[model samples]
Target: METLFGILNNCVYGILALLALWGAYCVILVWRRVGQVRFADEEDQDEFLSELEQALEMNNYGAVSELCEDDRRALPQLALYAVNNRNIGYAKLRRRVAERFQQDVLSDVEHRLSWVGTVIKSAPMIGLLGTVMGMMGAFANLSSGDKVDTVQMASDIQFALITTALGLAIAVPLVLSTASINIRIRKMEDLVGVGMSRLFEALKFAEA
Candidate 1:
């Protein structure tokens, strides 16, 4: 019975280790993607918006299209869509650009984020499972024999506490990372809104 309990404890440890590794991978991927979409600095932000304004003022569809294509981020794509489909008229062009961005860029970003959320939620449950298993082992030894094995009981209790601690350790940092990523995503959404507004202004400039 003790041997069986040991095997189960080892299994739980292995599973938690795997979960931690997966959480780490998710963080890395999210951070890299956020970096790509975010402006490098205040100067870069000013320059990018300034250039867009200039292109719109000059009624230069080619330049706007080129700028959007060159940027690998989210906001620029809106401009690309706007400039490329300008002949379709503003309302239809706006709808198409929005649909395309929602389906593509937003989906990609959220897919990775969903995994991070899953890990944060499940790791604690997994730890609780380990805790329960450890307690069962400790209690079983007390009931199964005339002479209780204090050493084994202590070990089981220790395992239970350790698993719970590990679970929290895995969860806490991920929660912070997830929050940071969410903030960045919101910023990206704001940038997209600003870009879309400017795009319409440019269209009006062209009409004028």
Candidate 2:
């Protein structure tokens, strides 16, 4: 029984390690994605918007499409969509662009974030399972013989404590990272909102 518990404890540790790696990867992916969707700096955003407005003012839809096509930022992508579908009129164009942006960009980010959330929730539970197995192993050892092996019992107790600690350690950092990532997501949304407003204004004039 003690040996079985020991094996299960090791398996739990292995699972936790994998969870940690998976969480880290998800966090990095979310970070990279948000960075890619947003502009590198305020200056770049300002420049792109200025150039787009100028193109729209000239009533050059081709220039607008080309400009947006060359840029990979979220706003530019949405702007391109808006320009391509400008014949639908502003009201429908605005609604469709919003839907597309939400479906394409934001939804993907959210899906990645959901994995991080899962790791955060699951890690602690897995750790607790390890702790339980460790404690059970220790108790089994204690009961197995007339002369108790103090050394083995101490090791089991240590394992239990370590698993609990490890679980908290894995979860806490991820919780903080998830929060930070969420803030960035919100900021991205706000910036996109502002950019879309500007793009829509430009489109109205260009179409007129």
Q: Give a tens-digit lDDT track for model 2, residues 63-140.
A: 888888977779899999988888997888889999998987899899999999999999999888878877887888
Total backbone collisions, model 1: 0
State each model's CA lDDT, in order. 0.84, 0.87
- After superposing candidate 2 on the true structure, give the runs of residues whose Cα lies further than 4 Å from its correct spot: none
- Residue 154 in candidate 1, Cα distance off native in Å: 0.8
Superposition TM-score, candidate 1 onto the true structure? 0.92
The per-prediction CA RMSD against the true structure, in angstroms, equals 1.7, 1.2
The TM-score leader among the candidates is 2
Give candidate 2's error at residue 81 in angstroms.
0.4
